[model samples]
Target: MSTMLQWPASRPARPGDPLVDSFGRVHSDLRVSLTDRCSLRCTYCMPEQGNLWLERSTLLDAAEIEAIARVAALDGVDTFRLTGGEPLLRRDLAEIVRRLAALTVGGRPVEVSMTTNGIGLAGRIDELAAAGLSRVNISLDTVRADRFAELTKRDRLADVLDGIRAAAASGLRPLKLNTVAMRGVNDDELHDLVDLAVEHGAELRFIEQMPLDAGHTWDRSTMLTRDEILETLSARWRLTEVDGRGDSPAERFHLDGGPHTVGVIAAVTAPFCGACNRLRLTADGQVRNCLFARDELDLRRVLRSELSGTERDAALDSVLRASVLGKQAGHGIDDPEFLQPGRGMNAIGG
Candidate 1:
């Protein structure tokens, strides 16, 4: 598909006019992919080899990322999450965090967070926290060392565990663990994963695997649903649904009693399209309104154009507004005619 090209000559978007889509859902969260290179080759996330990687010259630099983020913040985006195939792969990651930390929206400081595999996080958690990283969501599917090696094609389970401890010690509050439950894979270890979370004082969330895998062979029959997860957990612990979840994707529950909680993201079974409030910027600078969106607006072109600073910022604002205006009602994963996106989860910045 061709990128959106029309640009408005107006000034930057006003704070009064938030980034709202056609469905009237105002977006305040922006997810930015720093790079597409990763250390681990997870079976579910990518192929074992022959994976295509973006050239460093094509990616948005730290300055460009900060500029785009500033534009988004000026439009009332209050939350920014850095993501990637593995964000730590970027050498300038700490610098990026420090730059984004200086951003604010509507007189409030912007919240900066990251979604990482936690392989290289242990040694840098202190530096990252000092750079203004507020929280981290680590992706860990199984607790068994053998299972971890089999699933990710890496023997970094010990590294990840140490990273979790380092994160806690570094004062990354409300640490979160994300697990993708696949039937007959790691589904049998749900309780064990929860126990690990409780032990570390981190909230664990089970996510229904979507069709974003590199294999493109995701079958609904083999997938585990949210109801089944709750059924299994309820057998072991008393789970009380927490009220007022707001726009967050996770449906939270208290474990046994107060002070400990778990969450489930039923993206396929229980869609939260009406309340969806997020926009994504690919590392190569394409703007995506939905994870399954086939269309993209090329903001990188604007950033690289010969336009003046004012003109470039104005063009970026126009592209951002147009992208949000074109947001779809839902990802359409449950629709009979649904098709998986061409890009894998790693490329799309999960």
Candidate 2:
């Protein structure tokens, strides 16, 4: 187990960097990676030879994460989600959630959420919910046991199902399931997911396979378009679009039967760059302005060393300043000639 470290006292915070995109969207959400480490080895998200793990000493502790969350809250970031290769791999994860849940800015509590691979969630879900987690998004690409093993190189389907059940039982209301639509792979499971959502009253979201991972060969034909998924799902159940929501990438729709919804996230084929409101903080104390960004602000030095409250606030200002300016109009991956940098999605904290 990793030893707990003391965090410096909170500093008087300042406004966060305002991200006004060309599409009239302001960035107001942040995804903080507690660890780039994960147990699953999904073929589309990782390379056969994975990335070197980040140094433990350089990682931002739970206190620092909450402190940063408070700073971002001042900047209009009210929603924060903890993500990782699989966030449950972090031993102090529940404690981290507790710290983040205790944070508030401008007299308002920030919404806390997490995305996990569901491997260890069965045992941890209740504790996490008790610690102030409002929602959870579990990654479940395939349902078939053998197919899941072949895709992730792991055999934990029963555990995954148990984790989902635990999340629901723990009152992680409206729990979401994320599945990446890979060509010829798991596309047939579209109806299966809809059935799960309909039966469990959970929201299942289908994501487009983007080209930002280490396994870089992307076949357009194999790519499942958002329209295709909707068309397939609508056949069985009628879907009505929901209204009055922030700039979420997913298009939410309600099932005809009752109070169930399924969302389609089409980041690649239908770019929502204009409405993108998310900023990323990697496990190694760096801020990523965009998913396809090649540069990151190194904040580990300040977090580790002795810096006055004013100095820390200055560092946060600098990081956010650099981040907003670096936001891209859109990921240039559509240009078939582009090459991606950085590690796979797992290493990059998807």
Q: Could you say which candidate leads in TM-score?
A: 1
Error in Å for residue 124 of model 2: 1.3
Model 2 gets an lDDT of 0.78
Candidate 1 has its poorest 10 consecutive residues by lDDT at 1-10
Candidate 1 collision pairs: none
Q: Flag regions of model 2 displaced more than 4 Å.
A: 1-24, 48-51
lDDT of 1 at 338: 90
For candidate 1, lDDT tens digit of each residue in 271-335?
77777888999999999998888888999999989986877888898999999989888999878
**Candidate 2's residue-wise lDDT over 1-350, tens digit each?**
11112223484323553444434456678888988777777888775464677788878888888667766776667778899877898888999988878877567777899999888898888898889998999898988999998888888888988888888777787688999998689988999977775566578999998876666765668789999999988888898997744578788888894478889999877777766788888887788878877788877666666886868867776677567666777877777766675656765666
Give each prediction's root-mean-square deviation over alpha carbons. 4.3, 6.6
Instruction: Give TM-scores for every candidate, taking all chains together and pairing residue i with residue i.
Output: 0.95, 0.90
- What lDDT score belongs to each candidate, Candidate 1 first? 0.87, 0.78
